[model samples]
Target: MDIYALQQDIIRYSKEIGIDKIGFTTADPFSELKARLVRQQELGYNSGFEEPDLDKRTDATLLLPGATSIISIALAYPSKLEDAPKGKKGERRGLFCRSSWGLDYHRVLKDRLTKLEAYILEIVPNATVQSMVDTGALSDRAVAERAGIGWSGKNCAIITPEFGSYVYLGEMITNIPFIPDTPMEDQCGTCTKCLDACPTDALVGPGQIDAKRCISFLTQTKDFIPMEFRKKIGNRIYGCDSCQTSCPVNKGHNHQIHKEMEPDAEIAKAELIPMLQLSNREFKAKFGHVSGAWRGKNPLQRNAIIALAHFKEEAAIPTLVELVKKDTRPVIRGTAAWALGEIGNVDMLSVLYEALEKEEEQEVRNEIEYAIDVLKNIE
Candidate 1:
């Protein structure tokens, strides 16, 4: 079998099967990535979401025995929401990041990888293969960068000239010895747009991120957003896009070629008030297919409350009061109290003190007291 010919065939098949880009690389250990990760750990920047074992994350062989080659695939998602509903007073909408605008990318990429896997296995009857998307120990960006799919950008995204940095990445490891593609040269060229645009200053340096301060990571956490970032998070319910949107290369690269990637404007930019009222079932029915929902509704709901505060939506004050007075989750109650402080005026001070007297959770009490103080200061 001509592995070279087979590689070309696989690339063509990938395009036919909906993969936007494909590249191959040797399945050697990612030494540079390991070093970077170690540095990230030392700097206390690791987001606990990653694979705990660093060894398995950087070595392809550790994941798939006898792996000789790796395949990296990119699927571009839409950047702009068509007919997006505008947020107005009494009708504020919280925005999910562009990456979560469609159905969860993990499923989308898995389907593509499965199709490619079957094609390769048919060609090489005894080929060993393993594939993974975001949840895998292997870093998809590291695999894609090494595979020549794109250069790692200063924004910590794999930026393909064709798709900018708005691409979803997934990878496969196989025993087949396909020729590796040459890695792309860095093209960022002294641009600091992404760095300057980061609201949280999470981009500690070019190609480096302090995940703890990253809005994308913070939005998914189940805790109350730190007071400092609550204002910065603004109307973002799931992720932040300041860095990506500010990139000059990404200005005109909205790819909606994949039908599954089309954003439903209503859900992607959902109303803050309605979102606050959604029961678990309602949230799942509306957002379960999207990747942003993977963290469940608590974080999204909490963010929605904060988003209401950001907009100073006087309309959501009633809902915020309800959450503070009756929500079972202390995080929700506390966040709502904080939002009340942000949005409610002097007139609402008495209502907050009333809730504060009955609040059982010490944390919730603190938030109510804080809200009272903020309202008083406003008077």
Candidate 2:
């Protein structure tokens, strides 16, 4: 069997099946990435969500024995939300980053990868293949960069010339000895826009991020958002796009080819108030299809409360008061108290005092006292 010809056939098949970009690379260990991961761990910069074992993360052979090549694929997603709803005073809306705008990209990319895997097996029946999306042990960006799908950008995104950084990445490791594609040259020279635009200064330098300080990471944590970043999170309910949106290379690169990726303006930018009251069943029914909902409702609701504080929407004061007085979760109750304080309407001071009397959690009581202090200072 001519492996080169088989590679060409796979490329053609990928395009036909809606893969925006495809490339091949040798399945050697990612030595540089291993070092970086070590440093990131040492500095406590990693988001705790990554696969824990460093050896498993960098060695493709460990994932698939005798792995000789890797197939990397990129699918461009819609950057622009067409006909998006506007947030108003009485009806404040929170934003989900562009990545969670539509049906989960994991599902979309997995579908494409499954098709590619089947085609490869048809050509090379004995091929050993393993595939992964974001949740996988292998670093998708590292695989894509090595496979020539795109160059690693200063913002830590795989920025394709065709799709910029607004692309979903996935990879398949196989024993096929396909000719590897040449890696792309880094095009991000002297651009500090992404670093400057990071609200939490999460991007410590070009191509490096301290995930602990990243607003995107912070938004997904299931605790009270650190007070320092509550204001910085703005109205974002999940993830953050400040770095990607500010990249000049990403200018005018909105791709809307995949119908599955088309944003439902209502769900993507839903009103913040309604989210505060969503039951587990209601949250799942509405947002479970989106990738951001993977962490469940606590993080989203926590961020929503912070968003309400960011907007300081007095119209939401009653709802915030209700949450503080009656919500079961202390994080939600505490966050609501903080939001109420941020709104700083002296009229709500009585409400805060009333909740303070009944609140049992020390943390929630402290939040209530803080809210009372903020309201008192306003008077």
Candidate 3:
């Protein structure tokens, strides 16, 4: 097959599979990305993907032997109203980044990539094929940029004019040789909205993320949130989208307009009290199949407690009490104590005192004492 003809076929097949944007590139990332990844690791920004063994990742090469090019695809996950909250007065529109409102991207992309791989195999019977979503060492966004799909935004996300930065990236590494696509030039052009909109200053510079200060990381993390960012977390129970939301490209792509993905009622309008009440089994049942399932209930529950505390809603006191008294995870209990302190009520002193005595961990004990002090002062 001639290179030009083959490229056209691949694009047709990709669109047939429901992908919104397609781009191609040879398997070499520029030196700048490598340096940034190293710096990010040094500053503890890579903890999310730093596990000892990541099966889908490969660094020696983005492709197998005889590999000549890559086929990168972008899929759109439009926001849907079903994901929005209901009957909640004084609540800000529950903000879920448009990208995560639907079915899990891992499953969606994996299924689409599998189809692409099978199609390629049918044409080149002995062709080697490996697919990746966000799982691998391959830089999905970098590859997308090289493929001419879009320019990398200041938020460190791929920005497509048609879809903005609200696209999921996936790629296929192949042994078949093909012509590579020209890379796109940066179009972000002096725009600092994403940088200024960041609640945690995760975007230290253009295209640079500390991840350590990222709200997405904070909400997605398993450990207790660092005290510095707890108050700024707002009502975000899962992933955060402040930077993207503030981007001009992403302004009109909310549930009121786009309709590809639907949000869960519970998640869209997430009630701090109900989230606190979710049992382990219920938590799993509700979020297990979704991307939010990874951090399980602890982080989300913790974020919810903190959000309620920030809201200063007296209604949340009973829920916070249950968490402090009986939640098995000390991380949750400690955060519960912290939230109680922020909410500040006279009755909470007794609860904080009880937790302080029973609290075995120094961190939780300290938080409990702080809560006791705050409550006493409020009284």
Candidate 2 segments whose C-alpha is farther than 4 A from its true place: none
Q: Model 1 — TM-score against the truth? A: 0.99
Task: List candidate 1 segments past 4 Å from native.
Answer: none
Writing each residue's lDDT as its tens digit, candidate 2 over 1-379 gives 8888898899899999999999999999999999999999999999899999999999999999999999999999989988888999989999999999899999999999999999989878899899999999999999999999899998899999998999999999999988999999998888799999999999999899999999889988887777888888999999999999999989999899999999889889989999988999999999999999999999999898888888889988888888888889999999999889998799988898889888889988888898899989999
TM per prediction:
0.99, 0.98, 0.91
Per-residue alpha-carbon lDDT of model 3 for 144-243, expressed as tens digits?
Answer: 8888889999999998888788788998877676688787788888889999999989898998888778888788787778888988888777778888
> Lowest-scoring 10 consecutive residues by lDDT in candidate 2?
221-230
What lDDT does candidate 3 reach at residue 242?
Answer: 83
The 0-to-1 C-alpha lDDT of every candidate, in the order given, reads 0.92, 0.92, 0.75
For residue 151, give model 2's deviation from the true position in Å.
0.9
Q: List candidate 3 stretches off by more than 4 Å.
A: 50-63, 80-83, 86-96, 254-260
Give, for candidate 3, the lowest lDDT window spanning 10 residues. Answer: 51-60
